[model samples]
Target: MFEISPTEWTAILLSLRVAIIATLVATPFGIALAWLLARRNFWGKSILDAAVHLPLVLPPVVTGYLLLLTLGRRGMVGAWLAENLGIVFAFRWTGAALACGVMSFPLLVRPIRLSIEAIDRRLEQASSTLGAAPWQVFATVTLPLALPGILAGMVLGFAKAIGEFGATITFVSNIPGETQTISSAIYSLIQTPDGDSAAGRLVLISIVIAMGALIASEWFARRATQRLHGN
Candidate 1:
């Protein structure tokens, strides 16, 4: 009952690959946006925040369709990239990664924003008073203090990416050995004859991975809290 086939293994590996790439690629932007939301009050701040979080409120299929419209081969930016840079997103694994990253983006921002907000401004001010540049103060003070939240956000993004289906399928169309992630594979299995066993195995694997990520996030957060408290 627990035997996983080669196809299942492929799906598992692909899911991991997509989730890791999505999380890493999204981290820097997530941090920047979180910092902006938490610290800077500029024009259109509310609009930017709403845009970052629009995916959460929007249906996954709707998000995926929007990506298709903007990132598909014939899409404005997509066509330019394809013609100029030989890059394409439509019907490719990279597109799957893009979809996952966008879907998981909000998850990656919220915790980091909260962490940045919780940081005592005095610490940053002290660093600034000590002749540190703004970037240095952020690198030294803000980032270190917010590490736990960043880690948590990454894990959350990975989890969301691994489980993403609607957006990925809609954007990339579930091509095997390329865009077919575990969630998509499971979806295919459920629609196929005598695929129940295989789908069950994949479901179990998904559960294990998600649980492990959650556990790791909790541990990291707890450790960070302890360190912050000097305990």
Candidate 2:
């Protein structure tokens, strides 16, 4: 195998950073959304679900373009943020994380929703009868019982963030050391001459990362399941 370059190393770090940011920020919202979808009956619920999952079905490039329009310097929230907080997302790593997070939200929500749905309602009722507040019941009972699916969802979101390309490149433009994640770096290398070596190295890294994510997800899932069931 060829020795990895500093550029590649930076890209690796950036990729991990983006994935971690996306997963951590999205996980809490994922759990909340999952709970809402699983336990609540409200008007336009189907529409809410579809809107949340839109990124999964829509073209990632299209999603990126939309972000550019809505989050660009002159765009609505973007303009306010720049004016008030002096922050920018256009061509920034934060923008890359936003794109990845939006794209991976559905993946994080799906498994969590399934787990929430699987929870036995009788347990929650019994907790309520025993004088546990709703928040207490959720924190102690529903959340604990649904931990396995939440873990799975987080892992899946991280994997998706690591592999995110289209929306990231569209929103962040693949600036080295800022937004040039592994997937974007690989794409950049593949477009030039004598780039095969670097591309190959990145490809291997991608596989390893993917496999590692799968292994981690399995580990968390099993551990959570065991903790919940104690069998």
Candidate 3:
């Protein structure tokens, strides 16, 4: 029962690929937004913050439908891209990644924002006084100080991406070997008469992956604290 089949392996691998891509692509944006929210006080800041966290509160299916309407083949942006750039997001693996990224973005930004907020600003001021350029100060002092939160956020985002189902299936249609991920696979499996064992296996794997991510986040958090305390 524990032996995995080819199709299951495919789903597992696809899930990993989608999650990793989503996390990596979203990280830089997450960091930038996190910093902006943490450090800046521009107009419409509250609105931007609310928008960032909108996915977390919105129903996943609603979010997916919004993506489809905006990025679907006939969508304004989607049509322009398809015409000018020959790119598409609807009913594709890339769509799956996009959906996952949107779904996980809030979780990705929160920890990083909190970490940046927790930073002692005097260090940044001191670095500036020491003739460090703004970019240099951020690179040397701000970024390093925020590393742990960034890592934690990445892991959390990856975890969310891997398990994403509603948005992924809605946007990408769960095509096997194309857009089917572990969550969608399990969803399909449990609906079939002879798929109980397979579904059970996938469930177990999901549990393992989630637990591992949580543990890793905790470790990163501890490391961050230790580093901050110079221990």
| Candidate 3 residue-wise lDDT, 1-231, digit = tens | 599999999999999999999999999999999999999999999999999999999989999988988899988888999899999998888899999999999999999999999889999999999999999999999999999999999999999999999888987898999999999999999999999999999999999999999999999999889888877
**After superposition, which runs of candidate 2 have C-alpha atoms over 4 Å from their true positions?**
223-228
Say which candidate scores most in TM-score: 3
Q: Give the TM-score (vs. native) of candidate 3.
A: 0.98
Per-residue lDDT tens digits of candidate 1, residues 157-219? 899999999989999998889999999999999999999999999999999999999998888
lDDT of 2 by residue, 61-117 (tens): 999999999899988989999999999999999999999999999989998998888
> Higher TM-score: candidate 1 or 2?
1
Computed on alpha carbons, the lDDT of every model, listed in order, comes to 0.93, 0.93, 0.94
Cα-lDDT of candidate 1 = 0.93
What's the distance in Å from true for residue 75, model 1? 0.9
Best by lDDT: 3
Query: Which pairs clash (backbone N, Cα, C closer than 3 Å) in model 1?
Result: none
